[model samples]
Target: MYELKTKENDSSVIEFIENVDSPKKREDAYKLLDIFTETTGCQAKMWGPSIIGFGSYHYKYESGHEGDAPLVGFSPRKAKISLYFATGDTKREELLKDFGKHTTGKACVYINKVADIDVDVLKALIHQSVAFLRETYPNQ
Candidate 1:
């Protein structure tokens, strides 16, 4: 019996974005909302306390750790904007090659602002992540 801390909930995405501390990050949050919405054709949902996520998929690992997670998402944090995409997708690296300035972590792409990255590449990443998840988790 394990609990997933980042489960999706009935939180207000707009309110969350509006509360982003930095004015610039707040503005970029809105832009990202639009881009992710348009690209994934999925409405935004609040994941956990902070992440603004799109479509979701359920994943069951070999160890039986299972949970549903958003296909793609982003959070405008105090330090940097965190972009969430499917981690194991090989296509992600290819697309990131053309993506503008950003730093990658184990599960996030960090950007200072929306203008710091290529919106088109961001869209492609979103698209690929969703497709990969759907194919990997077909019945979800």
Candidate 2:
């Protein structure tokens, strides 16, 4: 059986932020923490070693692979911050159009810092991502 490597753990989100090497990145991480927390109305949890996540849902694939993942999350990486959101969400694409300076991948929206993006748009992304996951998976 294949297991997900990035499962949630009991690590301290603040501790993780403190250990981040870059001072500016550390500050950005705290800001993201606050944004995600306030926007989602969910407390931040450490996902794997690096990703700070909020809320969660379980998903079972058609292939029978199943796992629990955060509704919305972000990582303060060395080069840039990586925001995690539901993949294949059309609304997400629409919001990204006004999300300010950012790059996209299948599941991650990369941003240099919080100031580089509009916080309101980011909140919309969080709300939409959480709503989409809940509607799609329907599993707590």
Candidate 3:
């Protein structure tokens, strides 16, 4: 079993974001970080080397896989901002239908720019995702 690091290294998070060369990208990242942390009630942390993660949960699968991960998080990548959460093909499908200007992977949603999406809708999605995760992984 691997031990999970609990508290965030705020300096790392700030330094990493600050080092982003693009002013626009850096601005966008900080903005998203504020929103994500505010919305999730989770302290923002620098995950690994680049991800800005929020609220964490511990999970142990029947197959023996176990770890701690942010209940919800995002990565402000070069071209887009990636939101992480679990998904069902149709779950939150309606929300996605209404979520503005973005792309989706299996469980990650990508927003090209904050100006392109509805912030309220994004919050709703985060709430829904967190709720779903809580229900799905009750023990966590």
Model 2: colliding residue pairs: none
**Per-residue lDDT tens digits of candidate 1, residues 1-140?**
99999989999999998888888888899999999999988899999999999989999999999999998999999999999999888999999999999999999999998887888888888889999989989998
* Lowest lDDT 10-residue stretch of candidate 1: 113-122
Model 3 residue 21 distance off true place after TM-score fit, in angstroms: 2.3
Stretches of model 1 off by over 4 angstroms after superposition: none
In each prediction, how many residue pairs overlap at the backbone (N, C-alpha, C within less than 3 A)? Answer: 0, 0, 0
- Which ranges of candidate 2 are over 4 A from the true structure? none
TM-score of each: 0.97, 0.97, 0.85
User: Which scores better on TM-score, 2 or 3?
Assistant: 2
Which candidate has the highest lDDT of all?
Answer: 2
Cα error, candidate 1, residue 122 (Å): 0.6
Per-candidate local distance difference test: 0.92, 0.93, 0.79
Candidate 2 lDDT tens digits, 1-140? 99799999999999999999999999999999988999999999999999999999998889999999999999999989999999988999999999999998777999998889999999999999999999998858
